[model samples]
Target: MAIVALRAPLKDLAGGRSEVKVDGASVIDVLRALEAEHPRIVGWILDEQGRIRRHVNVFVNGELTREDAPLSADDRVQVLHSITGGTA
Candidate 1:
């Protein structure tokens, strides 16, 4: 199982959890498992087409990665939402 770390609102959506354990061979699989456990995080990580959102970033073992990236049992995954704002 990989340890997935949730940031900001994602963590809030996951019941205030900073980390979660999930089993998967790929990043998307891990995300799917996370969604299964926390339905509120559905569209926050993945889109309607099941793709990672552009405003969202995912990292594996501290390196940015795609959804299809392979994973190991001890791997760590981080899901972060990009903060955006406009100058007044």
Candidate 2:
């Protein structure tokens, strides 16, 4: 199983659960497992069309991950709300 951390911005959407464990052999599989338990949370990470949102960032084992990054049972995943503020 892989541990996935949720960002604070979407805490409400996740029922206040900060972290979750998912079983999968790859990033896609882990995400699918999360979707099964908390379907609503899927939208928090993935877009309506099932694509990762630009404002959301994912890290695997403490490193940033690509869209098709590889994952394993021992990998750690974290979701972060990207810093988007800029000078006005």
Candidate 3:
């Protein structure tokens, strides 16, 4: 299982969980498993096409990764919402 770490407000959506372990071969599979555990996070993490939303960032072992990126059992992942500041 890969350990998925949740950041800030996103953690709030996961019942205050900072991390979760899920069985998956890729980032998409991991997200699916997480969504099954916390249904409310489905829309927050994935878009209508089941793709990682543009505003959300995913990292595998500290390197940015796409939803299709492969995962290993001992891999670590982090999910964070992108923060953008408006122009003055």
lDDT of 2 by residue, 18-64 (tens): 88888887776787788888877777688677666777778898898
Query: Model 1 segments beyond 4 Å from truth?
Result: 83-88
Per-residue lDDT, model 1, residue 39, is 97
Q: Rank the candidates by lDDT, best first.
A: 1, 3, 2
**Which one is best on lDDT?**
1
Measured on C-alpha atoms, candidate 2 has an lDDT of 0.76
Question: What is candidate 1's lDDT per residue for 34-54, written digit by digit as tens?
Answer: 999999999988999989998
Off by over 4 Å in 2: 85-88
TM-scores for candidates 1 onward, in order: 0.91, 0.80, 0.90
Candidate 3 structure quality by residue, lDDT tens digits, 1-88: 9999997677888899999889999999999999999887878889989999887889999999999999999899999776743245
Every candidate's CA RMSD? 1.8, 2.3, 1.8
Q: Name every residue pair that clashes in candidate 2.
A: none
lDDT of 3 at 59: 92
Error of 2 at 7 (Å): 2.8
What lDDT does the true structure give each of the candidates?
Answer: 0.91, 0.76, 0.89
Superposition TM-score, candidate 1 onto the true structure? 0.91
